[model samples]
Target chain A: MTPAIAVRGLVKRYGRRTVVDNVDLTVMPGRVCGFLGPNGSGKTTTLRLICGLLTPDGGSGTCLGEDLIAGRAAIKRQTGYMTQKFGLYEDLSIRENLEFAGDVHGIADLRARVDAALDRLGLAARQHQLAGALSGGWKQRLALAACVLHAPRLLLLDEPTAGVDPKARRDFWDEIHALAATGITVLVSTHYMDEAERCHEIAYIAYGKLLARGSAAEVIAASGLVAWVATGEGADRLAIRLRDAPGVTAAAAFGASLHVCGPDQAALAAAIAPLRGAPGIVWQEAPATLEDVFIHLMRQVPDNAGQG
Target chain B: MRGTLRRMRAIIRKEVLQLRRDRLTFAMMFGLPIMQLVMFGYAIDNDPKALPTALLAADHGTMPRAIVAALGNTGYFAISHSVTSEAEADALLQRGEVQFVVTIPADFTRRVIRHERAQIAVEADATDPTTTGNALAAVEPAVARALARELTGPLAGLAPRAGPVEVVLHRRYNPEGSTRDNVVPGLLAVILTMTMVMMTALAVTREYERGTMENLLAMPIRPIEVMLGKIAPYIAIGSVQVAVVLVAAKLLFDVPMIGSLALLSAATLLFITVNLAIGFTFSTVARNQLQAMQMSFFFLMPSILLSGFAFPFRGMPGWAQLVGEALPATHFLRVVRAVMLKGAGLADIAAELAALLLLLGLVGALALARYRVTLD
Candidate 1:
């Protein structure tokens, strides 16, 4: 499949500080690419640069075979971007919002298109309700409806389900997958590990750098991390005691058990050897989970975002 | 009470620092008042002089010539054009090229020398009550004493009301000197300026403040497209306002309309667009709706004061007249009043029309240049 987006060496600097530095990204057509990053890790900036809402300080490429800088209008025409905040007019009705989106794209047969969008979102019954009055989940659905109104070839969603409930997030993911199945490329930024796991591929960015990019299992295996779980009558209490120990990257209590991970197996074992013999406690080596690797990756990237 | 005072002092300190940090706000605070003071001090004047007048002298004798010269010496009338016929003089007044036309009849010296109550007609464009009121009063006295020194021997008695010489004052266009006649036409420009600029400014600023601008810009629309779209609605609103004010002027205030309606409408549209463009430029520069509102109000204060709407245009000091000339409303006021009261044609008010067009072009270009194509 041809690439829907191909951009290299993207550099965005704000004054003396580089917000997005020497980044490269490409996602094949019809792929659901999940972007996982900590706060202010340039995910939103990168998405904006691709969609032509912002100009990159350096680097160039094509979006949908059109030059990113010169063909910005064409890129914007075929791209759907959902902002982190609800960007739809709150004063307008749901139907009105969709109609306005259609109008912005100069869509003919506006009423019919709006009707179809409303029906797809099951918002026909409350299409007359003001968008601001909708619940968080419904608002999210309305925003999604607006985003897909023009049948864009690519979608850039920035934390689309940040504050949504679990059921709503599941529903949103189901809708996203449905769109992906229809051969529309999607690039969604999220902080949720479960959401990240749902993507066809994952890209992890931290403090303006793309650190890891691959499938979930591949990312975990490539991190070279070791984790051990301890379960006993009172094993979880040892998490606090092991947190400050040398060679241990993270130690946290998971329910009545303790989950701990470190970079090297021997150092991890030595750090927990004394605790391993605790009364009635059993220590078992477990494959490190996706969250464990992500936490470990974040611990390695030095935070230079606060300076200059 | 003491605790409350301490808390209030803390808030004051915080507010002062915030005020100091906002450099633009600080500059405008000190700059606006001082600018207003200098503008008002240099430009505002109650006594207007050098009123453009047209001379149509048919009398060949010394008495009429002496009187015309005295009229010029009084510093009230500046004879800018000379006419041989009444039709030529009439055209000058209708075009609003001159405020008054002074006619010395062919029989003036003959009637005066025969002591037959010789009359001199000074027809004033009385649409502006203040401008013409003083000049008209000065005319009779000024002209009566015109040849006082030249009147020697038996002619001395002719100058001191010993013999009859009548000064026929014809206040044309508006004979009753209705303030509404002047104000109604001027309100067409003033009302449009106030509403169109502020409304368009708020509309753009609201989009930015609500974060909708990013969504709009992320689409395929250009900055010019956005500006035109934002201004289109206000154009309709401005038209409706013009209609309402026009109807009121005609029915309630009994204001006369002597000029071409189509011409007035065309000029009104141009004036409305100019103000809208100015407002749009303000929106791009302003960071928030409050700043937009303040900028609009700041612009309006000078617009209303210096546009010859509240005061006479020629009455203003030279500097104020320059500022007035810079504002669209000033030229618009001239166009509207000229067309409505004097029956000025396109040729008559070409200067005002050109000024408005120039303003529209300058402001429209500035708005497009300031409008950001990308968020960066």
Candidate 2:
């Protein structure tokens, strides 16, 4: 079957600086594709280009099987975009805002639709409260409700869970999964690894370049990261020293223990040879984590520290 | 189209809800008219009265006594003091104690009895041009009446030997010698322009700043439809203001209305729409509420000063009057004052209406063009 959203070698630039440098992405229907990247990694820009909000400097693509450049209006009509900001009327109540969103999208039976959205989001109790007076969690729920009220085929959420509590975040992801189960395609960009793991597939981008794209297990296994734990009187110092040692790629401290990583097993062993003694220092090999693989990937990529 | 209507209704409803919540804005929207009406009506008057003058009657004859009594009877002037010498009268004027000084020369009774050339020296403070003109005009009737009374006396004062005494007062239009009349009419322009434009500019811009505009723009509504929906309510409020100001003009200021109320109301609605369009354009360009207010004020200052509202359009130099004419408020004031005061008909005000309509069309089009339906 044709992919629900597909873009080929999209290139966009601001002035002379290229953001979203030549990248290809495709999202199958009924799947959550998490876009993971550091700040200024062009995730938001890519989303905008795909949604027809901005014209790419160069490339060709189709969104929902329509030529993106020529069919922007159609794509906009069927696409729900949630900006990072809370883009709802603060002075208006949740019910009023939802009603407005429904009316704007030309939804028939707006009152019923708004009521359904509020009920589905579990926000019926606070529907009469002003959006401005809502807490961060409630505001997040309201923003989500407004975005999904149109029942778009694709949902483009930009960092929707930022600054929200963990409970609220979990509840939000549950709602997103329910939407995905209904055959809706979701492309969400987030900085949190837990959220990324919740998606069916993850695409890691760094410095406007796509570094990796795969399922969680595939990405972790493909990273070739070897891990070891060190216990000692000064394990933190040992880890710091082992960072510059040959074959030691990453080093970090974790609660009275030190976790050291490297891509080559033998190199990691040889690198830890010096820490075998030194009085109370203990070194043992351990299982590598997804965070370690991502850190290793981030270390390999050249810095884009000042791109923003 | 149905979707657009739905969205328009949503925006209007939301705006009304917000307006109801913001009591200060509601108060200003309704209360300002009544306050300004009462204030300006009570403060303004056109009929001149109680002008200060000094009498220097060295003649001590029937003619000077008749003149003093006639001038005082006109109720336009009161002899605050009597001066023996021209120097004393000049001192009183220099000190700002008197506006006019009438001097009857020491010709004694012999000149009038001899029927020879007798002259009265009238020294006036010509500093304030408007007041000076009214004072001179007021003294004219008194001088004329006194001469007429003397000539018709039993002694039959010689009318043939008497020469006309010329009183030179400065300035013509609104010669009540009070700035209240001039300032009050101009105040209407200032108050309306600032309040209307600032209020409207803030209306849309607040939505943008508060993030509600994005929601509105996302709707299927056309940009022009949004502009119309926003401006219609202001036009209603503006119409009520017109009626209030007219009633105040008639009842308190005795400012007669000479033109059609219908034409005045029509012009006022056009003016409101034009101003509202300007404000809408500002909202489109401004980034925040503060910026919107600043931009509105910046635009209003020029329209208020350059518009012939505060100053006489003819008195301003050519380039300045050209600037004044460029503002819709200037033309509106001219049309309003003419229709309301001069009773000018449609034929008399057609050009002004055309200019105002042209401005409204241009501004409304520009506002629509400046509006964005989607984020870039």
Candidate 1 CAPRI-style tier: incorrect
Model 2 lDDT per residue over A1-308, tens place: 77878998898888767788888999998889999888888898888888876788888889888897897778877888887778887877889888877766788888888888888878799899888898888788788888888889898888899999999999999989999999999999998989989999988887777888888888888888889998878887766788788887788888788999899999999988866877887778887877787788888887854554
Clashing pairs in 1: B43-B317, B43-B320
lDDT of 1 by residue, A83-110 (tens): 9888887867788678667766767687
User: What is candidate 1's DockQ?
Assistant: 0.21
| Candidate 1 wrongly placed segments (more than 4 Å) | B1-170
What TM-score does prediction 1 earn? 0.77
Q: Which candidate tops DockQ?
A: 2
DockQ of 2: 0.47
Error of 1 at A189 (Å): 0.5
lDDT of 1 by residue, B1-376 (tens): 3423332333233224334554774465445433433343335434567999999998868888888888988777999999999999999999999999999999997887686888899998888877787788888778768756666787666665554776678989878666667777877776777777877787788788988878878877767657766676567767877776777667766778889989999999999999999999999999999999999999998888999888778888999999999999999999999988999999998899999999999999999999998889
> What interface-residue Cα RMSD does candidate 1 give after superposition?
15.5
Worst 10 residues of 1 chain B by lDDT: B6-15
